[model samples]
Target: MQESRLRWYGHIRRRPPDYDSNLALHLSLPSHRSRGRPKTRWKDVVLNDMSEC
Candidate 1:
């Protein structure tokens, strides 16, 4: 599941910025203080996968 998801992410990354999927990929949500920990981002996931490779 994760591998397929990552592969799809790669496809999305290759798309032009005007594409909805690409826009969504680059979109940032409003920031607010959190209690314990910060969330893992898509970039982090991709970096982790690359490091493993």
Candidate 2:
């Protein structure tokens, strides 16, 4: 699943910067303090996979 997701992301990256997928991927939200551990983000997963490669 991770590999396939990353592959799809690669395809999305090839799209123009104005593309919705690219915009969504690069979007960032304001940070806030949470009561518990933070969520596992897609970016984090991709980074881990990249390190493994």
Candidate 3:
């Protein structure tokens, strides 16, 4: 899981997912849905084995 999170952070940073795309694909909802701040802190969100810390 830790390794995967690191890879995912790289992927998201490289591509920098658009909010609309995130909502459509991950949330499976219309673009009009309300949004909130991301769950993870940006630094931890980009790190490896973050949950263990």
Candidate 4:
């Protein structure tokens, strides 16, 4: 699982800065949500694994 996440991370990183997938990864949207803990996002998973490396 970690290996696959890293592989996909690398693939996304290699994309052009303006690429949809890459851009979306860094997109931020202002919105309201219920009062509760937020779910872990795909980017968050990949980034957390990266920090463990």
- lDDT, residue 21, model 3: 35
Give the lowest summed-lDDT range of ten residues in model 3.
21-30
My TM-score estimates for the predictions, one after another, are 0.71, 0.82, 0.34, 0.83
Ranking by TM-score: 4, 2, 1, 3
Model 1 TM-score, 2 decimals: 0.71
Per-residue CA lDDT of model 2 for 18-44, tens digit only, reads: 989899988999988688998998978
Q: Top model by lDDT, which number?
A: 4
Q: Name model 2 segments beyond 4 Å from true.
A: none
- State residue 9's C-alpha deviation in candidate 3, in Å: 0.3
Instruction: Count clashing residue pairs in model 4.
Output: 0
Q: TM-score of the candidate numbered 2? A: 0.82
Report every candidate's CA lDDT: 0.81, 0.87, 0.54, 0.90
- Model 2's alpha-carbon lDDT is 0.87
What lDDT does model 4 reach? 0.90
Q: Where is model 4 more than 4 Å wrong at Cα?
A: none
Error of 1 at 35 (Å): 1.0
Best by TM-score: 4
Every candidate's CA RMSD = 1.7, 1.3, 7.9, 1.1
Q: What's the residue-level lDDT of 15 in candidate 1?
A: 91
Model 4, 1-53: lDDT tens digits are: 99998998899999999999999989988888868899788988988998999
Report the lDDT of model 3 for residue 39. 50
Model 1 has an lDDT value of: 0.81
Question: Which whole-number lDDT from 0 to 100 does residue 29 have in model 1?
Answer: 81
RMSD of 2: 1.3
